[model samples]
Target: MAPNPGRLDVGAALSYGFDKFKANAGPWLGITAIVWAVGVAVFIFTFASTLTAAIAAADRGESAAVATTSGVFIVVTAFGTFVSYFVNAAFVRGALDETGGPEKPAFGRFFQLTNVPQIAVLALIWTVLTVVLSFIPFLGTLLTIVFGFLLSFSLTFLLDRNEQAVTAIKSSFDLTVKNFGPLVLLLLALAAINIVGGLLCGLGLLVTIPVSVVAINYAYRVLTGAPVSPAR
Candidate 1:
């Protein structure tokens, strides 16, 4: 049974992320490089298109330019969310594989697809929620943080537990609430890690990002009493 306020050794969780990530560094780094490269390319393409549209609209009026840019921003945000899910699927599965067994992670697993319908529905719902949340400007950031925390484990639940999309979301919230304190600290630590990674001219992300994913999976497993193999 999970402890009240479920204990999660945040340090150990981070350690597990690093350790497991190290165990499968080749695939972890390679897949991350690919995903990073693709994401940057997509961002650059979308940004250039948006800028061109805004520049063209400027001839009409300032409001027209602002409106055009805003519309393009919305589309880019939604598209980015949808595409990020596929990248997430790869890392989530890789993290799970590394923690769940003794075998070395397969590089091909990074390209394998799983839980497609759930990911699609999940991405759509998340996009809608993000748009709706954006309307509550005063509290949007706080609410987003809370929701992000509560739903952090949803993907793991979907991939590792074979949960339905909605069920996975709800289950994650429920589990997270039971373990809120530890997980909150865990989240903060992850943010700090990534912040440092970013400060290192973004080169550090190749390591921190994979480590963070592994840490989150470790937290999920420990909070739920699932098995976790040490980094071997």
Candidate 2:
């Protein structure tokens, strides 16, 4: 089911996302549960001891004590974040496919790591860029937010289009620039939805997260000429 290539329309894409998510709630929720459960466990296992030690050092009046552990924390956190991006890309791929066709998405599909390297490269580039810019005072935060939204679809492009990391990043940048206004609006809307989800004991994310992914992919379909079903 090929999507009609058309100008990106944020409202239509979001509507398609909401409807698609409702149609496939069970599988989406199951996948979200599995991913987040593992994410939480890994976070605790990796950082619990180190974090406690850092706190203890700070209490002992040694402000520099935490610096030693901070390197390890950054590396591990980056690694975990990289992996999560790939996993989420899988979800985006499956959701986009299911929305455009009759077949359901498979649970194992998101684990396919064929594009892991590209995703990692993209993640690494963004992390470095954001961290560097974050040191620049007031403008840093605003730049990060704008660039973050502009390149939001980099991983999805890697997974869905099989583009190289640099290529995917460029594509995402161009797409966002072409549809800058709508993309900003979409980002804000998604942020609000996620905040509401967080307020709902975090369980509401089981719905909002997938819906967000679907909306982004719906926009991807618009830009890439993939077929999108009418919003139900």
Candidate 3:
């Protein structure tokens, strides 16, 4: 039988994601919310502190010092973002595995996975590509959107494959390139949710985060030709 080649069903994807959330809403939401809360608090504190430091440096007429401090803040934030990506991937995978399937990954195992050098290298490469792409004018903006989608999809793939991080990253790029349209729509949906989440002082994120995890899982399954189980 010929497979359906139409647009990927956004409605079906959203429904699947919602069902997955309903199945294990309590534990998954509780844990994720708490972790996100703490993460946000820490991020705000750091951001405020850095801003104050820059202001003080500027007040002292030390523009060079302010620039140096701003640079350091950027680097720290970038590093933190990279690390958080792995942590979120680990959490989503663990939560889904625990609630939706038989195997339960141990808490903090995702952090342990980051200890492998390949993971860091993969993250660095992904980061560099994203930055370089952002430099072009109109095309750069379009590429950024496309690249962002591929990047998210790729990260989920890497997390699921359990291969060396570099290999996983390569696989993600390959899968995304091969399935561009559907993946782009999926990524756009996620980005919309994130923007809404941000607008609501992050409360909307409670809904978006879990939905994203499931969506990424769906994307991964699609790319790998895995069986899609009914939502529990």
Best by lDDT: 1
Q: In model 1, which runs have C-alpha deviations exceeding 4 angstroms? A: 1-6
Candidates sorted on lDDT, descending: 1, 2, 3
Best by TM-score: 1
lDDT per residue (tens digit) for residues 76-122 in model 2: 66666666666666687777676565566666655655677777788
lDDT of 1 by residue, 1-232 (tens): 6433336899999988888887779998898898899899889978997999899899999999999988887788778877887788888888888777668678898666677899788878787777678768769877877787888888889988788889999999999888878888998999999999999999999999999988998888787878788666
Model 2's TM-score against the true structure: 0.84
Report model 3's TM-score to 2 decimal places: 0.75
Write one digit per residue (lDDT tens) for candidate 3, span 1-232.
Answer: 5333333566677677777777656655665776687687759866876777677677667876678676756665666656666556566565346433553334443334433465566667766665566557789778877666556555555555556666776776787787778877887788798789879997887777777777667656655666566666
Q: Provide the overall lDDT of each model, using Cα atoms, as 2-decimal numbers.
A: 0.84, 0.76, 0.64
Give, for candidate 3, the lowest lDDT window spanning 10 residues.
Answer: 103-112
Q: Candidates' TM-scores? A: 0.92, 0.84, 0.75
- lDDT for model 3: 0.64
Q: Deviation in angstroms for 104 in model 1?
A: 2.2
